[model samples]
Target: MSPELNAPGISEEDKARLTQSGIELSMQNRCGSYLQMNQDVLHAECQEEGIEVLSYRKAMEKYDWLKEYEWKAVPKDKDEITQYVASQTDPKGYVIIAHKGTKNILPIQACLYLGRETIQHVHNIIIAEEGAELHIISGCTSGGHVGQGAAHYGVSEFYIKKNAKISFTMIHTWTENIEVFPRSASIVEENGVFLSNYVCMQPVKKIQMYPTATLKGENSVARFSSIIIASPSSYLDIGSRAILEGKGASAELVTRAITKGGTIISRGQIIGKTAGTKGHLECKGLILKDGTIYAIPEIDGRVVGTELSHEAAVGKLAQEEIEYLMSRGLSEDEATATIIRGFLDVKIAGLPEALQKQIDATIDVAEKAGF
Candidate 1:
C-alpha cells in the first residue's frame, strides 16, 4: 500500500475495517475493481481486469495541460466554497490523471464507510490532453452501520483540452444519515466536449449540489444529464449549470427528479454570454407521494446570436398511466414502480451499452424504493 491509502483522521485498524466493509457492501458485481477511498484517504486502488488509469505522477508528467489548471477548480469568491478548499489534505481523494491522447475507461468508488459520526472531505481531478478520450463510472456511497451518520463533502474539477472528449457517469447511493455536498466544475477548451450523466435513486438524509461547466473555446460543447429519487424524510437539492463564454460554443442541461414523501428541489440553468453561443435547460419531476417537489430551470443569453431556452414540469403519475401498465400484467405496486422508473430514465448519447443498462437498472430500483 502507498502513503495515499493511509487515511489521516482514522486509525490504521479502522481504516482496514472501513476499506474492507465499504468495498464489500457497495462495490459488488459492478466493475472489476475500484480506486477505493475510505473517508478522506486513498484506502486502496487497483487496476480492474481491463480498465486502468495510470499512476497519478505519471499522468502529471505526460500532460502539459495539468500544469495550467492544477488545483484551480475552486473559485475563491465565496466563503462556503473556499471552506471546502481549506479542508483539503494531500491525497484527499482518488484521481484519474490520464496521459496525453490516452484512451481508457475507469471505474472508481470513494466513501466514508465508517458507521460512527465522521466528516470526510475529498477532491477528485481528471485531466485529458488534446485528442484524448476517456469514459468514467464513479460511485459514492456511505456505509451507515456503526457510524450512524457521516458527512461527505467533495469537489471535482476536470480539464478537457482541445478536441478532447470525456463522458462521465456518477452514481450516488447513500444511507439516510448521510448528507452529501459535491461541488464540481469542468473547463472545456476550444473544440473540446464534455458530457456528464448523474443518477441517484437511493435514499439519503440530505443532498445539495449544483455543478457547472464552462465552455471557454470556440466550438466547445457542454452537456449534462441527471436523474434523482427522493424518499420519505429525504431532502435533495440538485442542480446542473452550463456557461458558454466563447463564440460558437453550445451547452445543454437536462435533469429528472422523483420524490416520494420527501422534498426535492430540481434546478438547472444555461448562461450564454458570447456571440454565436446557444444553450438550453430542462427539468422534469415526478411526485409519488411528495412532501414537496420544485423544478426550477433558467436560461440567459447576451450578445449577438446568443440564444437560450428552458422548460420545467413537476407532477405525479397519472392514474391512467398506472392502470395502463397494469393492463399489461404488472401488479398495482409493480405498475407504479414501472411508471416511476420510466419517468426517471433520461438517456445519454454515446454512453456504452453495458454502463447504460446498468444505470437503467439502478434507476428502477431507486425509484421504486419508496413506492
Candidate 2:
C-alpha cells in the first residue's frame, strides 16, 4: 500500500467511492497525489517525484514562492463573500510546485461531508518552472443524497514559466444542498500553453465562479472549455475570462450549459490587449421547465489585428424527442432529464480511460438524482 493512504483522517471508503466520480488512480500517474477535504478536516498524500506536493503549512515552510501572489486571485474586499472564508481559513490545503523539464500528472479531489465548513476554504498554488510539462485533474463534490447544505470557497493561482505547458481538467459534482465558489487565475510566460477543461455533472444549490488566465509572453496560448448541468432547485452562475497581452498570443473559450430547472447565468469574456491576438467565446444553453438560462458573452479589444468574437444559442429539447421518450412510459421530468443528460455529453481527445469510465459513472449518478 502507498504510504499516502495512511494519512490521518483520510477515508479509504471515500477514496473508493470517489473513483466512481472520475477520480482515477493509475500506475501511469506521475508521483501520485490525492487530497480530500471533508469539512475542516483535510488529508493529503503525494509521492516523491519532480513534482512536489505539500500541505499549506509544510509548503509555506519549504517553498520560496508562497505569499508572492497573495490576494491575487480572490481579492479581500469586505463585500466579497469569499473574503470571510479567506480570512478564517484553516491551516490545511495543498500546494503543487513542479520542477523544470518534469512530465507529471497530478490528481486533486475535494468534497463536502461529515459536517460544516460544510464551508471549506482551500488555497491551492501551482507552479511550473521553465520547460516543464504537466497534466492536472481535479474534482470537487458533495456527499451522495446528502441533506445538510455546505459551501466551498477555493482560491487557486498558477504560474507557468517560459516553454512550460499545463493541461488542467476539473470536475465538480455536488449534491442539492452544496454551494461552490472557486476563484482562480493563471499566468503563462512566452511559448507556454495553458489548457483548461471544466465539467459540472452533479447538481448544487448555488455556484458562482469565474476563473481567468493571462498570457504574458509571446506565442503563448490559452484554451478553456466547460460543460455544466444544473438541476431543479439549483442556481449556477459560471464564467471564464482570458486576457491576451503578448504578441501572437491567442485564447478561446467554449461552454455548454444544461438546466433541468432553477437558473443558470452563463458568462464568458475575452479581452485582447496586443496586436496579432485572436480570441473567441462560445456559449450554449439547454433548458427545461421551471428553468431560467442567461448567456452573456463579451469580447473587447483596443488594438487592430486583435480579433475577438462570440456565439451564443439557447433553447429546449425538441418536442418530438421528449414525446418519443414519454411514449416509453417515462415521466415528463424523466424524459426531459434524459435529454439534458445526453446534452452534457463531452468527448475530448487524450483524456485518461480510467477518468472517462469514472465520468460515465458520474453521469449515471447525476441522471438518477434529477438531471
Candidate 3:
C-alpha cells in the first residue's frame, strides 16, 4: 500500500467510497496518481520514467510553454461553468504529461474527493507528446459526511500530438444531493488517437456535461463511450461531440443510459468537415420504472466525400427477452438484471484490458443491486 493511502486524514469509510469510484488506494498496478480533497491537492506523483505528474499551479510554474495549451481546446468564455473555473485565481487540479515516445504499461489514477466545500472547482490539462501513449483512470466521489447542495465544476483539456494516443476512463460516485458540471475538450494531431470512457452508476442530484473533440490531422481518430444510470432523485444530461477536420480522420460516439425512476437525457453529435472523413454516433437507453430516457443523436456531413451517420433508441426491456432468460431457471429479477447487463455491455475497441475490467466492475455493482 502507498503511504499516502494510509495517510492520517483518510478514513476507512472514505476509502470505501473512493474504491467504489474506481480509485486504487493501494497504488498497485498504477504508474501515477493524483488526489485532491475538496479544493486542496493532497498528492500528485509519477512512478514512470518519462511521465510528469504535478499540480496545475506547479506545472504552470515549471513549464512556460504550458500556457499556450491552457484553454486552447476549451474556450474559457464558452459557458458559465467554464467561466467559473477560469475565474479561480488559485486553481486546483492535476496535470499529466507523457514525454515523446513514452508509454506506461499501467494506467495513472486521479481522484477528486468532495468533502466540505460547497463548490469545488478544478482545471486540468493532459498532453501526450509525439509517439507517446498515455492511459488514465479518474475517480470522482464525495465524502460520507458531505451535505446537500454541494456542487462541483471542472474544466479539462487534452492535447494529443502526432502519432500519440491517449485513453481516459472516468468513474463517478456522488451522493444524491450533489450536482456536477464538467466542461472539457480535446485536439488530436496527425495520426493521433483519443479514447474517452465515462461511467456513473451512483445517485446524484443533477449532472450536466458535454465534451467535444476535434480531429485536426490526417488519419487522426477519436472515440467516446459513456455508461450511466439515473436513480430516482438524479437528473443526468450528458453528451459528446466530435469534429473530423482531417483527411481520412474518423470519430465514433456511443452511449448507454438507464433510468430507474429518474430523468436522463443522452445526446451525441458528429460532424464530418473534410474530404474522406467519416463519423458515427449511437445512443441506446432503457427505462426501468416509469422514468424518462431521452436520446438525441446528430450527424452532419459538410463535403461530398465526407460521411456521417447516427442511430438512437430509447425504450424498455423486452418482456420476451426477460422471459427467455427466466425459462433457463433464473428468477424474474435475475432475468431482468441479466438483460440490462447485456444492454449496458459495450466492448470498446483498443481499450486496455485493465481499464475494461475497471469499467466492468463499476457496472457489476449496479447489476448486483438489481438495476
Candidate 4:
C-alpha cells in the first residue's frame, strides 16, 4: 500500500474488516483508489493514464463543467439525507472520470471508513465519457471500536455517455450500531450500459436505499442485482428502479435476500415508456429463522410494443430440498448451509471475474459461520 493511502489510527483489526468489505489496502489489481476516513479524504489517486481520480473539492476547482453533472441525476431536495449532504460546508468525497474511448479492465476501489461516533456524509460523482468503460468497487464499513449513534449519509450520481459502459459493485459491512442511508441515481445515454451490484452480509442497525436509473437514449441498457442477509437486530429496506424512455432500451432488476431473526424488505420497479422497450423485475427471498422477508416487484408499460414483467417470491427453505442434500451423506447443518449458499447466488452478466470472486468470498465467509 502507498504510504499516503495508509491513514493513521487504522488498526490491524480494522484492516481485516475493510478487506471483508473488498477494500484492498495493497492496491493490487486496482487501476485507481480513493480512501476516506471519517470526513477526511486520506488519499485519491489514479494510476491509469486516461482516468482522473480527485477529491470532490479539487475536482470542482479544476473542471467548471462538473457543475453540470452535479446533482443532475439525484435531486438535492429529494429527502432529508440529500438535504444534510448538501448542507455540508466542507464537502467530502471523490470524483472519478474516465476520458473518452478509455478502457480499464482493473476497477477502481473506493473506501469509506467511519471510526468515530458521528455522522459521516459524502457526495460522489462518477462520469464516463463517450465510448469509455469504467468499473468501480466501493466498500463502506465502520471501525470495530466505533460506538453507538454512528450514521452514514451518502449521495452519488453517475453519468454514462453515448457508447459508454459503467459497472459499479458495492459491498457494505456496517456493524449493528450503525445506520446507513444512501441516495443515488444514474443516467444512460445512447448505446450506454449501466450495471449495478450490491452485497451486504453483515449485521446493521438500519439501512435504507433506493437507487434509480434512467435510460434516455436509444438502445441503452441497465441492470441491477443485489444479494443481502439480515441478522438479528438488523432492519434493511433496499430497492432499485429503472425507467426506460428511449426506443429499444431495456432493463432488469434481480435480488436475493435472506433474513435470520431480522427484517428485510426487497423492492424493485421498472417502467417502460417507449415502443420496443423491455423490462423485468424479480425478487426471491428466503427466511432462515423467525424473521420477516417482504418482496415487492412492479413493472409498468405505458406504450404499445413495450413489454414489462415482474415476479416475486418469499418463502422458507423447503424441507424436501434439505433432506435431499443430506441424503448425499452430508450433515444437516452442511446441507442447510449448502442450500442457502445456492439460494443467495445471483450472477451478474457483465461483472469482472475479480469482483465476482470477491462477492463470492464474502458470502463464503458468512456461510462458514452457519449463515
Top-scoring candidate (lDDT):
4
- lDDT score of residue 250 within candidate 1: 89
The worst-scoring run of ten residues by lDDT in candidate 1 lies at 16-25
Per residue, candidate 4 scores C-alpha lDDT tens digits across 330-366 of 8899999989989888889988888898899899888
TM-score ranking, high to low? 4, 3, 2, 1
Off by over 4 Å in 3: 1-7
lDDT of each: 0.69, 0.73, 0.91, 0.92
Q: Per-residue lDDT for 1-371 in model 2, tens only?
A: 23333324435665544554455444244345555556344445555467776777678888666788655644656236557656763654577776898865444333323223366677777877899876676767555545665777777788888999877777776667877788888998999888878878566788888888999999898888788887887899999999999999989888888877778899899999999999989888887666888999999998888989999999978999989999999988888878876776665554545445555667777677765
> Clash totals for all models, in order?
3, 0, 0, 0
Residue 186, model 3, lDDT: 96
**Candidate 4 lDDT score at position 189:** 96
Candidate 4 off by > 4 Å: 1-4
Residue 278 error for model 4, in Å?
Answer: 0.5
Each prediction's RMSD over C-alphas, in Å, is 5.0, 3.8, 1.2, 1.2
Model 1: per-residue Cα lDDT over 183-240, one tens digit each? 8889999999898888777678888898889899889998899887788979999998
Misplaced by over 4 Å in model 2 are: 1-17, 24-30, 39-43, 105-117, 145-149, 319-342, 348-361, 364-370
Off by over 4 Å in 1: 1-34, 40-67, 87-91, 105-115, 146-149, 367-371
> What TM-score would every model get versus the actual structure?
0.83, 0.84, 0.98, 0.98
